[model samples]
Target: MTTVMCMKLACMTECTRQGIACMLTRTVPYATVPSFQKQDLNRTMDLGLAEDHFSRPVGSFVASDIEQLKLAIEECKKLILELPEHSERQKDTVVKLIHLRLKLQELKDPEEDEPNLRILLEHRFSKEKSKSVKQTCDKCSTIIWGLIQTWYTCTGCYYRCHSKCMNLITKPCVRSKVSHQSEYELSICPEIGLDRQDYRCAECRTPISLRGVPSEARQCDYTGQYYCSTCHWNDTAIVPARVIHNWEFEPRKVCRSSMRYLALMLSRPVLRLKEINPLLFNFVEELVEIRKLRQDILLMKPYFITCKEAMEARLLLQLQDRQHFVENDDMYSLQDLIDISSGRLSCSLTEIHTTFAKHIKLDCERCQAKGFVCELCKEGDILFPFDSHTSVCHDCSAVFHRDCYYDNSTTCPRCARMTERKQDDISDVKEA
Candidate 1:
C-alpha cells in the first residue's frame, strides 16, 4: 500500500540502519491514481507524464547525488509528519521536496541530448561564417543565450528552441530547420542599452535585475519608443536575431536617402512622399550626384586631368580673350542665369539653385497656412520650426502670437495711431 517514492525513501533510510537488518520493498511500484499536477509559472500543469516514472521524493529533500538526495528527502518527510500542520517549516519542506524531485528527474533525461548540444557548441565555435549572435537556450532554460544556432520557433505556437533542440521534437514538425535561407530579417528599430540598476520589465511588470550586466531594451526608431525584452520579442516588429540585421539596411542611410525631402511632405494634407513634385526630387538628386562628381574630380586632380577641365584650360583660357570674357560672363549670378535659362539639363547651377530656393519658400508658405509655424515667430525656422498660436490685428492686418498679444496688448504696434492722433490735433489747432 506504500507509495513507490515512499518505498525508495524508506529503503535509503534503512541503509544507515543496516545493523537493524531492515527488509525494504524490492520492486518499484506504481500508483493506480495519478498525483495532482503542479502549477507552472504559465499556470498550465503538465500531466502527460505518469508519477513514479522515475525515483523521486514523495515529501522529502533531494540533493545533487542519489545518496545525499535520499538522506535529505527522508529527513524532511520525517519532520513534516511529526510537526504541527501550521509549522512554517512544513510548507517549505514540501516545496523543497518538489524542487528536488524535479531536479532528480531532470538529471535522468535532459531536454536536449548530449550529442545535439555538442554539435551546436561546435557550430558556434566554427570560424569564418557570418551567423546571428545569441546567448540563451530557451528550451533548456539552463544554458545562457550565447553560442547557439539561430533560434527556431513554432510557426503555430511560437515555442522557441535551439536549432539542435529540434530533432528531439515530434510532429507538428512541418518543415526542417531553416539553417541557411530562413535567417530572420530584423526590422528597422533600435536596440537600446540602459545602465540603470533598477527597472521593471515593460511587458511583465517584473523588476529587471541589473546584478552584473547592463539592462537591454528595444526602441522604435520612428515614433513610440522603448520595450522590454519580452514585449520587444512578442509584440515588436523586430525580433532579437533580426535587430542587428535591419539596422545596417535602414536608418543611417535609407532615412536620409529615400526620405531626404521629408520636410516637403509636411505641407500636404495626406502627407505622402509620392505626391511631391518630381522636378524638385530630380533636381535634388542630380545636384547631389553632381556635387559628388565634382569632389571626385578634385580628388583625382593629382593623379589624372579630367577632359572637360583640360579643354577649358587649354582651349578656352588660351583663346577667348580669356580674362576679359571670364570677367564679363554673368554665369555666377542667379538672376542672369534664370533670364538666359532654357533646356532642363542646360540650366546653370545658379539657376537650378534659384528654382530650388523658390520651391522651398512656397512650401514654407503652404506649411505656415496649415498652422505649421507661428507668424509671431516667423523667423523661428532659422533655429527650428515653431508651432503657431496666431493672433491677427484687424486694424493693421498684422498677425502675431495670441500669447504675446495677451501678455502685452490693447494697441496695434504697426497702426501709427499715436502719430495720426497728433496730426489730427495740429489740424484742429490751425482750424481754431
Candidate 2:
C-alpha cells in the first residue's frame, strides 16, 4: 500500500510540474454520511496543496504579485521556527509582521477591491491635528493636554492649572451669611505676578483690600491706619473727648461733635487754634494751655495726673461743695477720699462704706485698713503689704513675695516671646 501511494504522489507531482491544471473533484449524494466526510477530506487536501506552494523560496515565487504574500508567510513561518524554542515572544512578533505585510499587499493592489488607504490616513491625521491644536499647561516646561474638568486656567497666560494651584492664586471661597450673592474674587499673589501693593494691619498683619470700603471712608483699622480693631479701640489719641470725659465723670453732659473736633485736633502733631472754627477757637486755645500746664505738673511732680484724673478731681470737688463736706472731717478717712477720687468706685458714701466693711482687712505692717487684695494672688484674706508698683503676667499674676530671680523671667507657658532677630532670620531663609 505504501508503494502504491508513493507511485500516485509521484504521478501527481509530475503532472503539476508539466503545467497542467490538476482537477481532483468527487461527487456524492446529498443525504449521505459519505458526502460530509468527502467535504472534510477535500478541505484537508486543498490546505496541503496551499502549504506545498508556499514552501518554495522567495526567489522561485512570482515577485510583484499577490503570490508574493504566500512566499512572505512561508518566510515568516520559517523565521519563527528558526528562533529558540523558549522564544515565544519572538514568534508572536514575526506573526504580527506577517499580518502587517499582508495588509500592505492589500493596500497596494487596486484590483483587490478594498477601501482607499490614503483617505483613511488623511482622516486620522486631521483628527490628531485638531486634538493637539489647543494651548496646554507648561508646569516647569511640561505640556499637559485635554479639557480637564476640575482644572482652571490663568487669565494672563491661559495655562491650565490644577484646582489647588488656582486656589493658591485666588482667594479662599468664604461663604457670607448676610450677602446671598456668590462672588468669585481673586486674591493677588505676588509670587504669580499679581498686584500686591495693598496695605495690611500693622498689629495683626491681615491683608486690607480697598474693594469693601465706601468712597467717603478714608480711615480704616486694617489699611493705611495700621491699627487693628483692638488697637483702634484703645487709641486715646483718636478717641472722642466726650468719651474720655465720660469714662472719668459719669454724671456730666458733653457735646459729641465738639468732642470729636477736639480729638481730631489733638491727634495732630502741630496745631494752631486760629485755623479751626472761630466760635470754638478760644476754647481750643484754653485747652492747649491746660494741656501744657498738666505736662508741667507731671514734669515737676513724681505723681502723673492725666486728663481723666484731672476730670475726676474736678467732679470730686463739685461733690464736696454740694455735700458741705469739711476737709479734716473725722467722718471719712484718706483711703476713702482716694477711692472716691479714682472715680472707679461708686460716689455714694453709704455704698462705699458697705463694700469696704465686708472686704477690708488690716495690714500687719502699716496698721491701716485696706480694701485692695494682693494684685498678684487676689486672695482677700491677705492684704498686699508692699506699696511699690508691680507688673505681672496675665495668666498667673504670681508676684514675688520678695525680690527674686523668677520676677525677672518673662517666659510664660501660655505666651512665648518672639524677638525681632528670630523673625528677621526666618524672613531671610524664606527669601533664600
- Scored by lDDT, the top model is 1
lDDT of 2 by residue, 177-196 (tens): 11233211111111211123
- lDDT (Cα atoms) of all candidates against the true structure: 0.34, 0.31
The local lDDT score (0 to 100) that residue 348 gets in candidate 2 is: 52
The lowest-lDDT stretch of 10 consecutive residues in candidate 2 is 118-127
Error in Å for residue 149 of model 1? 17
Candidate 2 TM-score over all chains jointly: 0.13
How many steric clashes between backbone atoms does each model show? 12, 0
Candidate 1: segments with Cα more than 4 A from true spot: 1-87, 110-136, 139-166, 169-432
